[model samples]
Target: MTTQVQSGGMVNTTLMGGGALLVVGLGLALANLMTGGHASFNSGSDGVTWGLPVVNYVFFALTSTGLTLVASLALTFGNKAFYPIAKRCVFLSLITLVAGFASLALELGHPFRMLFAVPLNFQVNSPLNWMGVFYAVFLVLGVLKFMKLHASDWDSDTSKQVGLAALVTECLAGGMLGMAFGAMAMRPMWYGTLVPLYFLLTAACTGGAFALLMTYLTYGSESAMPEKVRALVQGPLPAALAAVLGFTILVMGYQTVIGLWSNADGMQVWDHIVSTPWFWIEAGALVAAFYLLVSRSSLMVAAMLIILGLFINRYEFVIGGQLVPLFKGTWVAGMISYTPSITEWMLTVMAFGIVLAGWAFGEKAFNLSDAPKE
Candidate 1:
């Protein structure tokens, strides 16, 4: 949902709206648990195990990592122009990571068991295992960095050092998660070096777009942006967004051509994607968002579209990747049909609800509207 702001005030209506969303989301999540969430997976014979919760997890997690990187531009790299926006970015990064973790907890069969097992047992060979480790590190570092940022000695050297550590850890965590998918030889659509590279690029782009949208929504479109925030938005952010979007388009095109030509099972997964309406929606949104981005016209619209496109991109990739029948015995018509159950939808809603509630909390607790001068 697009944020609403008026006359330098974030609308109370919007806050109420977010609250409403949270209530509905949480209610559905509770209902889902009562109904036995993942038990429904056995009803389908398809190999597609990951569903809406995973999609929600990927979307929030990628944005969180990207938002952290944006914060580091000012916090770690000492970019004065980016400083005004750093606090908001850092705060959002933390909230989104928390939201992602919540999704992970709900997705797991035994949530508490995962909490103990992930740290106690180390799997050196598994990217997913490494992903969990790094995710935990990122969360710890992020909280420390956020605290240091809001502290009285925020500008001190120690704060900067913590910021740097947070930045490095966040990048590593994001890369490892990308590698988790890229390393999946069983999933042809996500395999190889390209997927990881594409993941990072999209993360950066999503972060930039999200920051811009949040800043605009925070300050209200009618109000003037602070000079520093405006500079950062106009300067490096646009460049990063354009470069990443362009490169991703190129990568996608290459992947598509190779998939069609190679005729290999992994590459041929593109054929299934081509037939899906979701794929077209994802592609169209990306192209339209890119056009809006480069033109610098209707930026709020562009940022919203970009974020939507990224969300859809993650959704399609997660779902479409598993659509091709990996096991012929369980598949119907060479593909598994998956329409996320009501429970799955509820879990996704809950993930977003966490984000909305987190923002509301930050607005009050952290004074999210005001960026203090150094």
Candidate 2:
């Protein structure tokens, strides 16, 4: 017996539940769009432009990039220890990127127009344009890579080549996503070389965390996993997470210190940021997660904490950067306060629902555990 790993009942239930969430969320989102348009969102015309939707976009986008980078360890670098999970990582990357794009489509005023407008009116000097182009390429490459992997049953030289290309594309796309914020000269808080580097770092952390999380969810426990796969999970996975978390902490600490010391125009936003309980909570969660990983306490707990903290971190980074009004004493007086509307919340639910349902379906349909032959 091959230790029948398919938990059919559980997988089916998850699929149905996720599908229900997807329907409910999409119905609400469409209703909102039909009624009030983008005005339904909490984002104002003057103060806060990018709101929760953008945060959601960044969260999923970076996470997808992270998964691609993680998968590259095996596909591109030929790391045998990582082979078992590489297929899952690539599949999740595709699903999550689709989710991110869906959220962005909901956010944009005219989503379909972008399909043609971007290429027709390409602006080389614009970081946003480059970000869009890179991501578009990345999405296409991701699809091709997944197709190759699936067709070859996760073993092919051609798939490896595509994986290598995907790794490079993801780096460019991830960096561009950061540059989309860092390149904004008007937003002092977001402008810096650190933003892109931080994005890449967090991408790794989030990607690794998600991969670990899904592995645990699928296997239920270490004993359920194949002997060799379990060894890889216990040894290499947590070790990689630990190393990335260490670097992430250092970068976050330095970013905070720099924010505190800088007397730039929008730097005052940090004052408000440091005062909030969420800020400390975000930092605390990462610290706890790091400790858990190093202490060999629980990889599951660490993964959950890292995901939670990174979500909050993304929320803060997106909203906090815009809190300080560009023009003082105008219609916007002090720090702009924004609360995500129910519509925005529903969109987020929709994104999660899509990911949950897709992942569950993939698990039930595909042999995600089939390790590549040496």
Candidate number achieving the greatest TM-score relative to the actual structure: 2
lDDT of 1 at 75: 72
Model 1 over residues 67-116: C-alpha lDDT tens digits? 98888776777766676678878888888888888877877779998777
Pairs that collide in candidate 2 are none
- What CA root-mean-square deviation does each model show from the true structure? 3.5, 2.0
The lDDT of each candidate is 0.73, 0.84
lDDT, candidate 2, equals 0.84
Q: Write the per-residue lDDT of candidate 2 for residues 159-275, one digit (tens) a residue.
A: 777788888888888899999999888888899876888899999999999888887777777778877778777888888999998999888888888888999988888888889
Off-target runs (Cα >4 Å) in candidate 2 are 1-5, 8-10, 153-155, 328-330
